[model samples]
Target: MKSVKGHLRNRLVKARKKSAGQANIWLFYSFKLDADVPIIGDLEMLYWVSELETQPQVRRFTMEHEVEISLEELGDSFEEITVTRVEHIDGSIEFHQVASKQHDSFEKVSVPVRYKIENRIEKSHLVVIPAARLKAFSKSSLSFWLKVIAFVSQVRGYDLRYEMGQVGTSISICGDGTIETLLESLSITDPALAVGAVCRSVLQGNIIVDGLRSFGRNTRWRTP
Candidate 1:
């Protein structure tokens, strides 16, 4: 039984790596001022260093990962930009912009991501999906995963909740459910599905509950 468990563990790890290889992870950052800002007509530039591994032996793999943004054309009098943001729609995006009396510089900001396995029996990997995509998905097809998470949580004797906030997205699942069981329950075998499930599970119940409450409040307000 111990050996069998070990074999299963190895297989799970391999599967996770394979899935990750096919994963399309994205990062988006936005900077909004309380008021509009001035533009000098010069293009704004942004760049970031990423820690993605590149394997030379793999023809599909590249050794370097970097992101850059350039905004060259701008109106001189067009001061007061409401918001300034950069989105890494696909792949990774990172950068920093700063202003000061002495000097202005762009620094590298690190966005950390964590992935882990839960429940040895079920083999579920807890992954943190990007927030931009969460917002996009929440606009469509979010309820499906909510039901899946709720059902899976109930079946596996776990409390599964998706918490979406202004800052980012997160998922909480606690009980005797294993990672494998959680993944299986979601019926996710591909990278897209895996990431989608993570994002869905994270954004599910809270937004729905909040919307329902808001609706009820509005209805009550209108009630004579």
Candidate 2:
């Protein structure tokens, strides 16, 4: 009986290897905001906290080498944040909050809110990337470049920069404006060309229609 079991296990493993072939690699990009960023309106806050998922897929590719190649090409132009907690509430005026601490900061604070979709809003612009994407780019140089572009796209509302290294990618979000200012900055001088460019870029990344941002570790929160 033991011998038969061992044989079956071996056969199963071989079958899986044959059928599964290679894993489809993907990167999960996420952004975590401070719950108090004020720019996020009620509707946008709800969607960000309640409706939107914490994880966003910035890009995907089959070959690990290709991913590394992309990251290298981009280099020092992406960002990453880990969110500790997020919440939403319904009342006369709906609101949401997110609390977190980044490596660069000594303490956590509530970020101003900004209107997103509907009455929902985002306390802060948070983005996440999945483990799959990491594996794809594990041995490539281009992974860093790809990450930079994806990070920039995700936090279009912020003044952000990407830092690249052989070790990994880093993103920095700058806070230097009000919600109105942020929105104004995003105003496309050429809407048609801007829209076309965004569409094309998104397609290149193979991002899903319902792609959402994922929160990260070290997140903390309070509800009222």
Candidate 3:
């Protein structure tokens, strides 16, 4: 496979010529850069990053890996870690060696990303997905979040976003409350379903969540 930079650059150069989905560019706002960054990834990653930006606890995000790797050494498919941020509330930006996902999904306890350039291996301090509050990064937690992120970001994304468009207007008018309470007022009974809707709104930049820590029914939220 071609290098990440090379592939993206080539795609960008011929962007206008490429048909439909091939040329679709995603612009994501980065708190760290204080500007919109061009995002390239699948819908799951796009949704994950978007959700992170809305949470109060999240300070910023940084790409973990965007470098060349040796296909001969690492094979056709290696871990292509993108943006990652430490979970600690330091008010300081830092990325470090994080453990590889035993299950998939990052919450804490980071591991290093290894890549090859010109047949030389290099290490990058890109934290994998990290949840707030330092811990060993549970397998179960990772699996759950990974499943949720994957599903909401990919599988049911379209339907959810369409629903969120309507839900967001109601949420903005409904006033402030935890995700649970607000959805309850709207007669949305399922907490999981409610969280997904609110989260979709958050991604759409219509509504806002008060916190990113342990996002659930009790998570505080508001409209912007």
Residues 59-137, candidate 2, lDDT per residue (tens digit)?
2111101000011122332222212233322211112212211133322222222323345333232222223333332
Better of 1 and 2 by lDDT: 2
Ranking by lDDT: 3, 2, 1
Q: How many clashes in each candidate?
A: 13, 72, 13
Query: TM-score for all predictions?
Result: 0.16, 0.17, 0.35
State the local distance difference test value for candidate 2: 0.26
Candidate 2 Cα misplacement greater than 4 A, ranges: 1-54, 57-136, 140-155, 158-206, 209-224
Model 1 Cα lDDT, one tens digit per residue, 1-224: 55523322232211111122433443322111112222221111111111111111111211121212212132221111111122232433222221211222223222321221142111111111233333433454344433433332332321222211210222133222332433444433353344334323333222222212212112111100
Query: What lDDT tens digits, residue by residue, belong to model 3 across residues 1-224?
Result: 86534433332211122123554466644433445556443332333443354344555555443343222334554443233443434564334322222434334433344554466666543333333222332322333333334334442423554556557667767767776676666545555565566655654445565333455667677777
Q: Which stretches of candidate 1 lie over 4 Å from their true place?
A: 1-130, 158-224
How far does residue 171 in candidate 3 sit from its true spot (Å)?
1.9
Query: How far is each candidate from the true structure, as Cα RMSD in Å?
Result: 23.9, 22.5, 13.5
Model 2 lDDT at residue 60: 17
Cα-based RMSD of candidate 2: 22.5
